[model samples]
Target: MASNKFKIILWSVGILMLIFLGFFLYQLTQSESVNSIMILLMLLLGLILGGVIAFLASKKLVSEPAVITESSHTIAESMRKVFKVVSAEGHFNEIYNYEETTKLFNFIPSKKKALVIVQAKVLVGYDFEKFKWEVDEQNRKVKLLNFPAPEILSTETDYKYYNIEEQFFNLFSKDDLAKVQQNGKQQVIEAAKKSHLPEVAAEQMRTLLTELLAGKNFLLENPAKISETKNLIDYRNMNNSR
Candidate 1:
């Protein structure tokens, strides 16, 4: 590549010299010749000097570093044969009343309670690691057997406390905060189990695979056994609790 670029630059210099010579001769012929020989020598010297400057400028322009807008740094990476695809997501917002009691003596009891507000999101999808399939490219046949089951992929929960009440003997402890948060998160998970998020994600996955295989005209041999993921996670029915 460097050799080719050098040859191109040499050809450019030769062409420039020819153009300057032709122009100088044309102008000399049109005007009266007082010192034509001296003018010719001077023109030759100027052409060489100008061509050298142009060549150096072109080289400088080509050698300048490329401009970068984003210098992104990679922190972590991993290789995976199959990745879990989240096809559907749902949000569940509910208020949970966390109540607890502690026994100070045989008959006396200390009470503590808080109105816990639960806000959470549930993501449902299929893990491709469990997927089973068979493909025949020769006969244009695709058999999709035991498909990956759509399950609760992940969940995010946030809690807020309101109207917290407790006696001096049964004030909030370190375990109380963790216990309330766990209880609120569990409620959201249980609610997601009854929703239709899993079913919707399964349907979306089916459509995606069908469209992908349509281009190659691969007939789905086993379409009956594909939709097996039970419906779970419904956003509409995620109602607030007291």
Candidate 2:
């Protein structure tokens, strides 16, 4: 609406300026004196002032929000109701893998259409870690993965271990890092109990969750254990293995 008003104001200003120019031209042709120049200057000043006023008026109109009706409210409610109807029911589980030292939660909805992995970590001293959500759709199924950070492997070490401490330390201060670890641990327990995930998956999830939430540093800093869980396998590999 504001955009339309601006256009109208622009058009009005243009028309008024054109009208003033035409009058000024007539004066110049009819009279040849200093008074004619002054008249033309006055016309220019009036056009400038008018343009400014019109621009301000248009801005004022555009900045205001539009009013909504009861009908719009009803439409929004109807859409929400439809969404609830179509949404499927799924199961959730928390898994901890000893090898990976990570915790993860798996959610399986009634639709059997998507696999979602939610990873939550703590950032520095902040109460919450950045959450990342990734969704992969395959064979009419959607796989969603959400984690604080992307999985990192140590190239120097033969055994690939997820260095939770190193990762968190890199992002946060020492004090903040400690808090993040504590939160990560709590989150793992919550995800496990809440999701009621499978035992195998829950174990791996717990490992990672504990490392992230433990409030302490990892045990083996150099020769870190590698991640070899089936869940860690690429999506395509998961399908092929199945």
Which candidate number has the best TM-score?
Answer: 1
lDDT of 1 by residue, 82-198 (tens): 587888899999789988887897678888999998998888777777778999988888887777567676777778889999999889988889888888887887777777777
Which ten-residue region of model 1 has the weakest summed lDDT?
Answer: 233-242
For candidate 2, the lDDT comes to 0.38
TM-score of each: 0.60, 0.24
RMSD of each: 22.3, 23.6
Deviation (Å) of 30 in candidate 2: 3.6
lDDT of all the models against the reference? 0.77, 0.38
Model 2 Cα lDDT, one tens digit per residue, 44-71: 8887898798778767766567797665
lDDT score at residue 205, model 1, on the 0-100 scale: 85
